[model samples]
Target: MGLEASNQGFIWVVRRNNNVNGGEEEKNEWLPHEFGKRMEGKGLIIRGWAPQVLILDHEAIGAFVIHCGWNSTLEGVSCGVPMVTWPVFAEQFFNEKLVIEILKIGVSVGAKECNRVVERIVKREDIKEAIRKVMVGEGALEIRNRAKKIKELATMAFEVDGSSYCNMQSLIHELISYNA
Candidate 1:
């Protein structure tokens, strides 16, 4: 959805799933090359692996399209970027619920049960629909608002005197006492 419309004004840097189509060779070359030839400007940046900090730290990013993996779910939450959830396997479905139902900062892009041996292809239309709801329609604003609030909380939790910081201090103090 984002890439197809990149030339229209949006700029996107997409990390193509390494195991796209469940083990097929990475198609990372095709997207940017194709878009580069098709579009006049630098509108898309597609790669096999993502630059996590580059994406998360960029202020221009408003939303994230994610597979709802545990690490990525937390990354999005910590960054306060609203997400479009698309889970594949393992506990990803549970993570999706946390992002969509519990956090209320992300929206789901429906997926059926995944087969490890089979390749599942999501239609571009479906991708567009989910993105549309998140980027423009429905509860987009609310999702963004919640994400911002969570970002503040995430920042506080990691800063000095915050919950995580205090917990770490307590643990360190206990360990030092034992050594003494």
Candidate 2:
């Protein structure tokens, strides 16, 4: 799909495994080699792991294929990039709900169980459909607009008068009082 002409403008980035969490180290090393055989000349950029913040920061990033972790969810939301949600774990399902159902800023890739162990596989058609909806399909404009609005709110949370900022100050004052 990535090598297709229509997807030329998009960059597909993937994280193969978690070496830190005891993912198969040998296979993890070899997986990239195998991956490079197909994706080296193509537009895909595969890595073991890197700071998602850096990738999401790019303006060209339209949608994120995320496992729906809270941090990844926040990064995608705060950056105003709509998501292709594939949540696999406990809180991640809730995060997917928050994005797709509550926040209305993303589309689901329909990953029910955890893919870490391959209980369920999100197929190519599912991926293509989600990507199309996010990048160029019917809901693209609505998704993008909602994401921009969310980005604004996420930004305001960090300002001096924002909820997050005030909450931080309150926590600090409480800690000081306790020490005193």
Candidate 3:
């Protein structure tokens, strides 16, 4: 509903796991009736695997709605995309803090506790608000600038003489020496 109200083009990736309910039919019951028809050109829902990194790297992408897992957080940072963080479990809340408070590149959707998807629901209005906060108005520009700066630094870290590259080399050398 929030996505619909936001009036933004989105690509949503859905993964199916055996642990979700009992079967495929049951799992799909979560989606609203005629969701695809209603969304039409506004959204694309990709079932199973999607090339997440490739999708994130695309230029048209504005803000990422993320679960605040470490990998997804890093992907969003590297892609230089501001985020709407919705943390659910484990260290996700801490990751959300890092993105929202520490990095200043994200806004939280106020997801606090971990529970069943239905129980921990963030309201559509709140979701829309967070996304709007990150993607609209002058504040959006600032967040995008911060995200761009972070992306620049993240890109530099992978260069030949960059900090990350050097650290990786050192680790490999130490491992080889220890094994020898």
Candidate 4:
């Protein structure tokens, strides 16, 4: 509902949980009624696992809505895409802080509590607002610039003389010497 209300083109990836399904009849009961029909052209819902990296790297992908997991956060950063953070558990809230506060590359959906999947803690308005902020709000350009700069830095870390490269080399040398 939020994505639709945002009036932005989006691709949503939905995971299939074996435990949640009680045969084909209740397969899509979790979604808003006639969601697919309403979002036909504006939104694409990919079931199961889609190519996340490929989607993020696409030029049309303006912002990422994520759970703020470490890998997803890093992926969003590495891809130079700003995000709408909706953290649920574990280290996710910390990661959201990194993205929203430290990095200034994301907007939070005001998800404070970490609960089970059955609870819908974040409201549609919150999601819409966060997505709007990341996509076209006042700070959107600055956030995007920061995201791109971080991506460049992340990419540079792998260059021959870059910090990460140098560190890797040092580690390899130390290990070789110890083994010798």
- lDDT per residue, candidate 3, 108-175, as tens digits? 88999985544777899988888889989569999999999999999999899999999999999999
| lDDT per model vs. reference | 0.75, 0.78, 0.89, 0.90
What TM-score goes with each of the models? 0.76, 0.81, 0.91, 0.91
Using lDDT as the measure, the top candidate is: 4
Where model 4 places Cα greater than 4 Å from the true spot, the runs are 19-26, 117-120
Worst 10 residues of 2 by lDDT: 1-10
- Cα lDDT of model 1 by residue, 66-180, tens digit: 8888888889888888888889887888898998888898767677667364588666677677777777867888988999999899899989999999999999999999999
| Residue pairs with backbone atoms closer than 3 Å in model 4 (clashes) | none
The sequence of per-residue lDDT tens digits that candidate 4 reaches over residues 89-132 is: 88998999999999999999998877665575678898899999
Worst 10 residues of 1 by lDDT: 1-10
Candidate 1's displacement at residue 130, Å, is 0.9
Ranking by TM-score: 4, 3, 2, 1
**lDDT score, residue 19, model 2?**
68
Write the residue-wise lDDT of candidate 2 on 1-180 in tens digits: 422423534555555655687764535453334555565565555455666788788887888878899988999998999988989878898999999999998888888876666678666677777878888988899999999999999899999989999999999999999989
Model with the higher lDDT, candidate 3 or 4 = 4
Worst ten in a row by lDDT for model 3? 18-27
